[model samples]
Target: MMKGFSPTKYILKSFKSGKEFKDEGWTLDAPGEMEPSLIRAIYDKKQIDVKDDSWGLYKFADWLPIGRVLEGSSAPVTYKSEGLAKELGLENLWITFSGYWPEKGTNMSTCSFKETEAYSVCGRMTPEMDKVLVVASAGNTSRAFAKVCSENNIPLLICVPEDNIGALWFEEPINDCVKLICSKSGSDYFDAIHLSNIVAGMEGFVAEGGAKNVARRDGMATTTLSAVTTIGRIPDYYFQAIGSGTGAIAAWEANLRLIEDGRFGSNKMKLMISQNLPFKPIHDAWKADSRHMLPLDDDLARKQVEEIIAKVLSNRKPPYPIAGGLYDALKDAGGDVLLASNEHAHDAARMFLELEGNDIHPASAIATATLIDAAKSGLVKKDDLIMLNITGGGEEKFKTENELFYLKPEIVFDINPGEDEVIERVAKLF
Candidate 1:
């Protein structure tokens, strides 16, 4: 068993009820099959004090829920952006990047922030799981989890839309323990999700629990953890473009942990989350001052998904309204959703490349553009500390030096499949 690690406690983030179960691996009690409410791990940051020198994200082992992380794990890299700050007329702009920008030491070769969650999610798993983990993602997430599980020889079955399979590329061939399942009839991330749920019901497979997984939320929380450690205090406004808003929630969770640590200051950082236009579900909901999503309001949002520049920002159903999820995070942080046009994101990407000499993912460009708007609208002042999570970037640079190995799906299926046929195909791999 992995040693030198033990949870301080696991509690319902809403109820704060986990002091009753005083050990690791306790199942959180919940009603109905929705896995109940999300659970969070609480740690004594001082007693479990994280040594700053530990490489990558492991430096924050004091707060990470997982006992073990993959070897050579990477963390979100943060830096004070002089050029972009000057361009946007903001004096205190910090960039937290997670991708293959080597000079920044960002080694997440998937070129996505999803790797943060991947390492943490896989880290929490062990051989004793005895079941293959089934994950559904649009692109970046599937690629991130596949890369991490492959490196560690952990069993994973990834379900992704057929078109998004191209994004599931790695520098090396995938491990034999990992399997990719393509959803042929699936048109979007939601379709892929529908298919994966069916596959997860089989005898030897387990759903990775999309948004509800504590490991993922805590893992991505490291970006926030890294920012506070470097800035020496939480920023005034935290920014990121999110599909599921899970990253923003992770940031909020990490903020609570830092406050509890009693060393990272007490003020809450405001969240300025963004979404690309033509498909802004969360943005529309927040605009209407609603906690629960009003899909009828953004009916055109679904019709316009293909037109959006940032396809990854097209999560039709995010974990926003759930208890302890995005809505709670935004409310806790005094946050609002930022909306951007294709022109907005494109302009930001151009400015970033010209000024910073680095390319940002479209989703990240949306965030960058929103930050500029926030500054111009006087919502944020010149010297307010701001942390912009460039959730993913450096793809153009990464491709210049590396060869990508794209894996073909071992099985192609639809939302409803013959159970025996799916099982037979998967059993052969195990």
Candidate 2:
């Protein structure tokens, strides 16, 4: 049995405080919810050890701030993609794939890395808060939470945009506790978030903290742990595509932990996070060397979000520029943001499918495309060890092999809905 398998304390990054804490309730460290903050797990290293192949994500349970492991191989699968390496002409290339590809044993039914956050956050909840867990997503995040909630018989409420309803698919029958509320066509991801927040305030509902959740952040850090344990060392560069940029922050935090663990080489890994063109607020902010994002004209941002192929990367208000947020993560890792256009994403997706024999999510394609740009621009040397986080993939094969049971919306509302009846309608789901 793994000793010290559960985290002992929660450290608030912004406050520079490391206090022993419990797993229940909201884990973010700010005095008030309005002041944004992030927290992490601090383990008892004397009893903790990340054993190799230790039954999925539980391998890093010592660091994950959850009560129990969800019954599945929830950790990301990491491997050195030789064919992709040879094609990209980089001598050392690792791919951390997080999606359904049973042949390789990476079975994320939602087909996105969002499931990592879902597992940890769901497990972190206190039984006292028997109220339903509420999550807002464009598609992947909500679908991930819904499937997991159904599997575990945990009550959950998913608020999502209507157009992306086609994205929510489950091989098994959904449980009654999983209720989906989708907004109309013009209602984008932010609309879904707005609605979810309103519901969160009402009785019998608890908000699933977005980037602020400690379990969610540490859960994502497993990707880095998976890579380090597999490769026996950290890579020179880390690549990923971000919406809320939480994953990149997770990677940086994981790197820091690994450095403290003294197993992986102590050198800092450079983050090469990317975004889809025309709608890249975080990317634009990084380019200007500014902590804050370029002022967003909501209408313009929405239009750009529509134009981008990677709809999952269209989070309007990301965690960037906040204290101990994405900006700090990038600064700590000596990282920079890269831009990938639609053409780049399309070409890269084709290249990945041909080379790796698996279909990747559009956001993952954008990350691969960013790698291509880096290789072409001489930003990365041919022999540099690189880790490409194929954040989501295997859609084509997954769809062909399994039956997709699309989840129907329990309630559909108009754009930016503000009726008191909406809250009453959601309350009835419990």
Model 1 — TM-score against the truth?
0.91
lDDT accuracy of residue 216 in candidate 1: 82
Model 1 residue 296 CA deviation (Å) reads 4.7
User: Model 2, clash count?
Assistant: 0
Name the lDDT of candidate 2: 0.82
lDDT by residue (1-430, candidate 2, tens digit) is 2444553344433423433454446656655345555666666562336655545666777777766566654568988887778876888889999987777778887788888888778767755668888899989998889888888888998999998888888877799989999888876899899889899898878888888888888888888888887898989999999998999988988888888888778977899999999888898888788988789888888789889999999998898887768998888888789889999999999999898889999999999999988887889999888999988988788788887787899899888777697887887777
Best by TM-score: 2
C-alpha local distance difference test of each model = 0.79, 0.82
Task: Give the alpha carbon lDDT tens digit for every residue of 146-216 in model 1.
Answer: 88888888888898878778787888999988888876743667767777877788888888887777788
Task: Give all candidate RMSDs, comma-separated.
Answer: 2.8, 2.3
